[model samples]
Target: MLDQALKNQLAAYLQRVTQPFELVASLDDSQTSREMQELLETIAGLSAHITLRTDGQDARRPSFALQRPGSDHQLRFAGLPLGHEFTSLVLALLWTGGHPPKVEPELIEQIQALDGDFAFEVYMSLSCHNCPDVVQALSLMAILNPKVKTTVIEGGAFKAEVEAREVMAVPMVFLNGEVFGSGRMLLEEIVAKLDTGSAAREAAKLDEKAPYDMLVVGGGPAGAAAAVYAARKGIRTGVAAERMGGQTNDTMAIENYISVLETDGPKFAAAIEAQVRHYGVDVMNLQQATALIPAESEGGLVQVKLANGATLKARSVVLSTGARWRNVNVPGEQEYKNKGVAYCPHCDGPLFKGKRVAVIGGGNSGVEAAIDLAGIVAHVTLIEFADQLKADAVLVAKLKSLPNVTIHVNAQTTEITGADGKVNGIKFKDRVSGDEHLVPLEGVFVQIGLVPNTEWLKGTVELSRFGEIVVDAKGHTNVPGVFAAGDCTTVPYKQIVIAAGEGAKAALSAFDHLIRLPAAA
Candidate 1:
């Protein structure tokens, strides 16, 4: 299952194992079970402290459990943990074998102190970039505390179970048989959910913090750049974001990023976040900012209110809240989200394998999604509201050449039709004839565009008609001590490289504004 180079790397990593562990696998006469056996054998051969047992009585065939001798703490994988989940498997092995994890000491203690039993089942796709974080987080909890157990189920490997649960998305987490969450989640966020009082404690801590010189309100590429640039100026800096990676975490292939030949969104986001942390920036992830209160006096601290009821004060604020995927907002769309209506093709495509699916929009994202889904799905129906496809000529040509793909231009998506609590078709109308048609499919992929996450700043700052934060060339907003950058601002192109550059510009502009402030009383 693993190549020679990968085997060598696995062997090297296994050398850190200070305790003995076992890979107990339940197998059957299926091909997947055979492959699982080979994989377990290969892994056991890599380390002296590892043992393989094929007599596991797990009901799920082709499944394995990583367990320490005489310890109830365990982590299980019901399918091959390759692709993005490969890292999760490696980390589980290391952590189970007494190798130290990189998480904070406080978080480790919290995991160990959890009270109730947590049987976490994460349904994930191999192509999903966001699943590893959740899988690894739960695995860490399981390895740290005997009360926690995690089972990562590969969606592609067990299609019947996925369909039975009506799971239409990757990284769909279930706690004790009920749905817990449906997307990427941070380790801290998971613990915060389990430990209810953690939020109150964190809010109190944040309220006691001193005012920062520069405070960034997002954790995307733009926010990371802004935080790093500000911290490098020898001034106090802080970053508050709902999620550290933001929309970048949802992105798939990123070949357009300069310097780097090719990479994925999660990798790029992790790299930038590491760089920001390297500069000693105080990053508070999973903190949602609900309101912006400008300083009462000139050169005073700007108070940013968080959803947790804590307010952070900063002399200069960089608003890089970024953008989210634009929803179709048609009828049944909301009711069927993750019930067959999904925005991410890379993450949800595997769930609809050999099934018909529709892609809404004709731009690069829609066209690219169609092309990628054509291989996994039985058929791809591309719907565009414009008269013609807005994608590049090369991409359009490639899409047209696909045999299983169909294109519909000048079509408006009216509603996503579904029954039995799952999507079944999509309704659209042709602009020329005003004729409405319904395309029968099992899934709908919305790739229209992005809408700025400036809804909270509607009354606080000057925004464009399209709801983007109005910013000058220097990234300064209408507010005196406030600035905006990236997709949330008036930037023409919403590219990662452009966002990073704009973030730097906004940081520099904030610094310039700070130096001219009058002496505080």
Candidate 2:
């Protein structure tokens, strides 16, 4: 064990660095040699990172643990840190340094200004190298900001801990006892996050022990569609969501939708939600689910938990979280969201029906939306950042058929200019001529692409590079008892009707598994 003088010096160093620094000893085994025990205790006493404890700690607390700089950036490992993972440690050091590269300037400002304590817990599997980057990024934030502390836990070594938390995937991040965003994060983004208020806290608290036959994790058109179907199946289904409508809430006016002559977006979302409620499905509003755990052998049941303390044990699980719009990753894109900004033409195009609107990207979705909007809007500008339109030949031909739609080859949107509460025009640069021009317009529809919300699911389930969940037509994950459907899953189309149909398929598949479980047991 280290000498008492060294422990006192370490403690003084930690206290001088920051305030409200707390310690949490992460002990895996109690049985050890006396020398080892003494060493651990001595280390614990000297640790500015963790507090030594005699009583065991509850697993849930780590996710919310607050950190104060000098005392908070704990990088302790029981064994020698080596192998490819050693690279992560070096990166972590770089993160702790001020002004890490690739970090957004705004994010740095937010992190530097943080005063409240926050903890970040990330679950990682052995196979996930992507997770290490996130861990490193978060660790950097902890070191830079005295108020933030981060922890990286190996999923396999923490089985009981993970089970208690109901973690369904690797590389999952929980902030302040609730889930923050998952997948990849830029250093600048992490710094920026320090300024934003916690979404999990404003939502419901986790229950840890709720009961339901099935739990659906989304509230979008796909998730709502799934919930209605699951309720009809006579299962006690619960739906948890941050917002009820998902991307469907942002549509302008869906014209091509079958059976609907011309309908607005908000109305469509409301109608779907109404239908789900008619069946008495438990819909938890302002709630976000963080993880999903499969049912274990020997009477174990699937468990769904949320950022709030609320949890539900289920015979089946349906993931219909749907997709989020993709950003250009360019400058000024974020500041323009909902200003001159838009994702769905059917949702926002009619607002500019008689005016001008510029559509970015040259995919089938972009071409289709442009073609449709050309009929109702005055001037339709289609901008393809690529050299050629990569859409199907038939779609390209159809778009060319529209006289009102002007297709600009090799054009990219650089910035959006607006006045007051609405969009007025956009700035674009010609890829060929290097000429930049501002096109006056009332709307701008970004059809670049959709990103599925499955980044946290790597190694936990099969996912395409596009981040869509891979499932059989029946909506089953590669693993048993877990099912997925809608836009978030690997389906060909991303239509509301298709999602509704897929929701039904997933429910039936889950029901089949539950029915057979009794016989098998």
Total clashing pairs for each candidate? 0, 22
lDDT of 2 by residue, 42-109 (tens): 54455354444433254432221223344545443222112223445434433332224455475566
Question: Tens-digit lDDT track for model 1 on 188-224?
Answer: 9999999999999999999999999999999999999
lDDT for model 1, please: 0.93
Q: Against the true structure, candidate 2 has what lDDT?
A: 0.66
Model 2 steric clash total: 22
Which segments of candidate 2 are over 4 A away from where they belong? 1-209, 252-264, 296-299, 344-357, 364-380, 387-405, 412-444, 519-521
Best by lDDT, which number? 1
Per-residue error for 233 in candidate 2, Å, reads 3.3
For each candidate, what is the lDDT?
0.93, 0.66
Give, for candidate 2, the lowest lDDT window spanning 10 residues. Answer: 76-85
RMSD of 1: 1.0
